[model samples]
Target chain A: MTMGFEAGQDAFARAVTDPEAALPPGVTSRRGEADAMRFAVYRNNVTVGLIRALEMRFPVARRLVGEAFFRTLARDYMRHELPASPLLFEYGDSLPAFIEGHEVSESLPYLADVTRVEAAWTRAYHARDAHPLTIAELAAIRPEDLGATRLVAHPSAALVRSAHPAGSIWAAHQSETVTPPRAWQPETVLVARPDMEVTVRILPERDAPFAQALLAGEALDAAAAKALAADATFDFGSALVGLVSLGAFSARTDDEDLPK
Target chain B: MTRFDERETGLPRRSGLGLKPEHYQSINDGEPDVGFFEVHAENYMGAGGPPHRWLETIAAKYPLSLHGVALSIGAAGPLDKAHLARLRTLVERYRPASFSEHLAWSTHDTGFLNDLLPLPYTDETLQRVCDHVDETQQALGCRMLLENPSTYVLFEESTIDEIDFLTAISDRTGCGLLLDVNNVMVSAVNHRLDPYAYLDRFPVERVGEVHLAGYDEAQDGAGDRLLIDAHATEVKDDVFALYEHLLRRAGPLPTLVEWDNDVPAFDVLHAEARRVDGALAAEAARRNARAA
Candidate 1:
């Protein structure tokens, strides 16, 4: 008997996700044998395909965990999470959390954070493109208006904060040799695709407050104030020059600062 | 109305290869005489970046075809409008000579499975597939070619034959066909059917393009060989024979050699495409000699 579409899909989905599950009703292999062997092909395809998508997003994670170990972690995540959209690039939003909760990966506390930085890099790479604000544009802003200027960051800009030096760890993997620093240090990473090149740069913890504030739509005056509050040694001028050089902002509005 | 009727010209009757990102520089530098390049439409769905830039450079010289793997045309639910919109944008931007999707579904009510899951050949599915094709055509404002899936398992469901189902969909929706000879070979070997006989009954006239890919050989518990449409290796000699047979009957068509996994060097894929071109030329010569 022909199975209904919904029922057939339900069984097929279950069988693919779980190997022990029996083949869906009305399914058989050639030579009239059990469908288990053939069904495994689809199961393997789904598992392998999703794992590859995740691997593309988190190459550093793969390198950190090694090939076989990473596949095991990724397969566990795949069993629990299916891609909500056809966009494979956006499939690993939960990977950081998955790695964080994973007990086997608990020893590597910094792994999840590194994954978060990688995810941010991918999102930034695929994010919407826009002509970034030039240094000349910043210079053109009136001196008096500079503090009150509200900067608009490009869609391809992202800031990632982590307790461990995940950004450094990720960078180390990019080159031939990967050597962690002797001393452990927390890191804040800025990921952006300015001029169509994805760049990941590490920032001081003090810069997090300023970048976070600006990304949250705060005016420059309050953002700098918040940064200075978090860390007294924060150099506003150097930070501004660095950010502008990174092509961070897409537009800057000179709206008057509201009375505080 | 038929989109590929007398008023329209289909893809060039020559050989093409699936475009991979790694081969972008080599393809541009060497500028191979490939008739066209086919890419999965979803790969270029990014807003802007290297994908678009590379596609632009390639499109400037070669005809392109947007082959989609995520449309899920045989699913029970409504078509995903957002995905369809992205596809429309790509088609508009690239203006590929041919656009096609699999007859299988990769999506369900929950989320995309990301695999070309098989469907039972039944009247219910036929209606669902036809409706999906119509909806997709209406949304894209252009005709699409529906590919026959390479299925591993067979559904015991009672219904029409595979070729009839495909032809019915074509007849009702006025959609063209992307006859994947590798898929036919795989399914035929799996089902113990004659690959040649399967092609003998195929609707050659409705075929707008052709696909040739490699398969992995595996054995069942009974020790019988099974062919998996893995697209990982070079085209098998048997599959190539089937391709030659079909080309001799259908004349030269837009043929694509798909090597997605374990993608070989540019030279290797180019050699395969050239082999297909050689076959097409031979077919043309045979036809010309018969006419003379």
Candidate 2:
């Protein structure tokens, strides 16, 4: 008996993703015979198209591991987790976590963190558009009320805290001639698309806590206290200015009135 | 409003090129003399970005065709309502001259498979496709052109002919057809059918637009010629001949040159579009000669 349309599609989809699976029932060629080679076209399209998407999304990861190893990793990752959405750009959200658990982590401990940075970069690129708060707007706020101000993070602002020098690693791979980082240390990278351009900046380790707190909607005084507690020498004024210049915060719309 | 008329494509009868990011700067600066520009709807689904910015600029200058690659109109289940809503939003935003999708399915129970997969032609599948088309047209408040698929494999249970199946869907749903000539060559050669005969049988009156692309050749399991719709290289001579033949019958239609994979520089793509324009002009001259 021939399989119904639904069952046949179910089987065809299964075989398309899984190279080892048998050809779906009722699938044939002009010769009226089961043709694995012809069916392999669909299989190859799904796998290769997805692998290319991953390569485009994470060029740094692909470059670090080489094409062959990256293809192997992507194939294994795809087999377990196919994209559930049509938005290919948003497909590999869980890849960083997946890489963390994979055996590659033992060899390259920073691979997962680098993938996280790349993933966050993609997220920031596609995040909703908003007018980034300008430094001029910050200067307008009264000094006494500034500490109570809860500046909103830009829609595209994202901070990826890594135990490895993932930011330096990603930056090195951007150019043709890559220079290895002089010293390997933990880094916190900020990914944001304030206006048109997506910028990746490595923040000072001492000020990461404050940036994280501010991005989390904490009041300015509280965020400053968090940074000061982490490092006694942390400068609140400079860090706030650096983040504002990086377009980390959105313009104040809802909270226009100062807290009296 | 009543069902959309097939003649109301809102696109000029000339050749266009698929828009690519690499060519955006050149397109913005030079503003080449192409008929229109087409983009994959999913690429612009992002809320706000350079893609949207460039598209907004280009759409203001030229006609836009919103082509969708992942609607999975042939899927057995109901259409994805969320995706349909997204399409509606895109339509409202761009107000493109024409919109199209494939007759193939890409989504299934598992997830969206990126490639356009073939389906069996049967009464059940036909009814499902018709329903999907109706829903899509109603949701977007505009007619859609369903392009035929390039298949490497066929189903033994297929009861209806491909051309007839397409005609039936268009007739039932009041949707128009997008006759992809390259797909005809690919499918005909793969299935041991005649390309010219397929064109002859196609309902050209219902065709709102046309597509021209290149295909990569390979061999099937039985060593038979298999053609993959790679859309990577230049349009094959035989495919161009088939397109010219289509032009003789359909007259000048809103044609698009699609090079999705391995996209070349703007000059190369523009050169291909110029070649298409040459054929279209020749066809127009012939039509005038006949009228005169």
Q: State in Å the error of residue A20, model 2.
A: 0.9
- For B1-292, candidate 2 gives per-residue lDDT tens digits of 2576556798889999999999999999999999999999999888887888899999999999999999999998789999999999999999999999999999887988999999999999999999899999999999999999999998989999999999999888889999999999999999999999999999999888889999999998788899999999999999999999999988999999999999999999999999999999999999999999
Per-residue lDDT over A1-260 for candidate 1, one digit per residue giving the tens place of the 0 to 100 score: 56688788788888888877887888887676565678888998999999999998999999999999999999999878899988899899999998888996678999999999999888887777777878887888888988988888877888888889888999999987888755589888898888768999988688789988887789888999999998999988888878877877787865243222
Task: Write model 1 residue lDDT over B207-266, tens digit each, in one string.
Answer: 878999999988766777778999999899999999999987889888999999989899
- Candidate 1 — which residues are off by over 4 angstroms? A254-260, B1-9
Alpha-carbon deviation at A191 in model 1, angstroms: 0.7
**lDDT of each model, Cα atoms only?**
0.87, 0.92
Top candidate on TM-score is 2
**DockQ of candidate 1, scored on C-alphas against the true complex (2 decimals):** 0.67
How does residue A176 of candidate 2 score in lDDT?
A: 95
Chain A TM-score compared with the true chain A, each model in order: 0.94, 0.96
TM-score of each candidate structure, all chains considered together: 0.96, 0.98
CAPRI rating of model 1: medium
DockQ for every model, please: 0.67, 0.82
